[model samples]
Target: MTIPLADDVFRAPGVELFDFPPLWEGAPYWLTKPVVLAVGGALVVCALAWAAFARPTLVPRGMQNAGELVYLFVRDQVARPFLGKDAERWMPLLLSLFCLILLWNFIGVVPGLQFPVNAHIAFPIVFALVAYVIKIYLGIRHQGLAGYFKNLMFPPGLPKLLALTLYAPLELLYTFVTAPFTHAVRLFANMFAGHLLLAFFSAAGFWLLHEQPSLVGAPVGVLSVAVAVAMTAFEMFIQFLQAFLFTLLTAMYIGASLHPEH
Candidate 1:
């Protein structure tokens, strides 16, 4: 009698359920992929920033020109409008955040570098936490702790009972939770979903072409390629939009913290 192996125990060795691995994998202390990407991206941004602004120029050239445009965009469009008189002081920080995030988002779309650093939640969470800290610090610096809390939780002119019931929860949700959570997740979710969808269709096209081995799969693959291109263009727009949105929300939060009455 011939012996048989269990189907579950014996299977094709090379088949994978999905083409890509899960986002995270267990690893030794220093080898985590997300950490590497975060550090690498940060270093690259820093280097670019240094190169861009190392030597001040009367007339900008190359990276300097690009950097100046980005700075003006953030300062004029985002910081100035929201922060007003105080915007000039915060221009550098705001511009850095915008460029860092914009670079990370666009890096995902580059061929051969498929992973978006922001698609991983940790990076965004860290940035959001920083924003939270800055907002709270500025709020307290501008208004003493008691005054800040009052401004936040008990805005003047509202009935005491209504303030307690309505304003408290709203303030708590907006400040302590929703602000950071939404700010971080908005970019993370967009990049994550966009990349996943692109991967799915692109891989499906390849699989169809391989399995069918005929002209039938060719058209489908062509359509998939077209869609992938379209989605890439859309992703570029989203990359810029998300970066700007993140910076804008950050400016708004800072503005609120600085002048909580508004």
Candidate 2:
């Protein structure tokens, strides 16, 4: 009699976890799980905002209190240090962006919806593009087109030859190409890796004891579950951090446009 190995009992999760088919027959290509979750995230954000701010009271309570905390966090930690006096003006955009992303990332760990919207490259790319467009528009409007490019590529007080030969080309490349790519990719990569890690441990726990209930496999299965629980908590923290970072970077870009670095 041949004894089965652990590999036979468990199938390791992979990139396949990120892929989803259409919900129903003849459904459009874009109407997959991730897309639906993305829309749901937006609606959830809107509802939260409405609940928190729809009717003001003499003193904040419940959802309003929660919303106020989130608002203050973004305003103080994200917008003000970067945007300064203009922070309030940009709060609506920055707050919405941060909350939407936080919701999307949290959904990855949700029981039924185990997918992060930003894990899909397209979603992050679209958000990054929005920030990029705003940055360019604000830069051009506040500072003339030539002045914006000058500040971006050639910072003030730099020596002429080195600025032209060394810094200018690199800065131009960073501003136009590298910044936006990294902006989206930073969020995408984090969510992708986190979700993949969670799926792997989850599958390991389920498969080890359930599929092949053996003496040796039982302890390992329990350990796998313990690790999954720990990782889930850690992943939640990471999800929140990634959302903050994405929004912080967006604020930085917008701030840089309005007031170029010296």
Candidate 3:
């Protein structure tokens, strides 16, 4: 959404947080700032990966050092506990997912690129769809078709007769339906709400002082700006956490898919 900057100090700033127009008159229906940011974020990840690993050395330096920290963070925190010895097998996927998501979310705080791509439902849905497909494919490959459904719909923890009648449909519904819905919505919803909140406070800051027409609201405007700045910091931490969680959940889903019976 475009911030309505007041031309005059006494004019009210608009707070339209969810409305955006096409970047250009001739642009395609899907072309918008968020789409550009999503593509840009992906390119940034590729460039960073290339810079880090393009010319490998025995001793890490510059971007490689930073990249290694990120790689190890994902490998240790995201992969090892979930995949165990298979961790290294999937390091490439997990690491890429983590970095891509982190960059996507981190763009929200960047000066010129304040929009988070994941705020657009399409972006998160695409990633979730990929993960969902991978999950089902892995499950079928490892457990066999019938075994996969059996393991999923007929979990062993529940009583046999009760499980057949009660938990079976619930389990199927959760795995087949609710899981992916929540998966995409969680990221999209958070980014959507967060960006709106930041925009609201920022517009309030300008509106109170510029549009108030008196000194009475100046202090409130200052307070609004202060709160906006504070929320931005908190938003950064939340962005990181959300990226980590999305990757972590992806790993968990894949792991369960691969070992459904276990």
The prediction achieving the highest lDDT against the true structure is 2
If both were scored by TM-score, which would come out higher, candidate 1 or candidate 2? 2
For model 3, how does the per-residue alpha-carbon lDDT over 43-107 read when each residue is reduced to its tens digit? 99999999999998999999999999999999999998788788899999989988888889888
Off by over 4 Å in 2: 1-9
> Any idea how many clashes model 3 has?
0
lDDT of 1 at 214: 56
Query: What are the per-residue Cα lDDT tens digits for candidate 1 across 1-262?
Result: 0112232232221212212333457555545555666677789989988989999799999999988888889999999888999999998789889988988888777777666778777788988998999999999999999988888888778898999998888988888898899989998988777767666566655555554445866888678778878988898899899999999999998998887766
In order, what lDDT does every prediction score?
A: 0.78, 0.89, 0.84
Give the poorly placed runs of model 1, Cα more than 4 Å off: 1-30
Candidate 1 TM-score to native? 0.86
Off by over 4 Å in 3: 5-16
The best candidate in terms of TM-score: 2
- Candidate 1: the clashing residue pairs are none
**What residue pairs are clashing in model 3?**
none
Q: Order the candidate numbers by TM-score, best to worst.
A: 2, 3, 1
Better-scoring candidate (TM-score), 1 or 3: 3
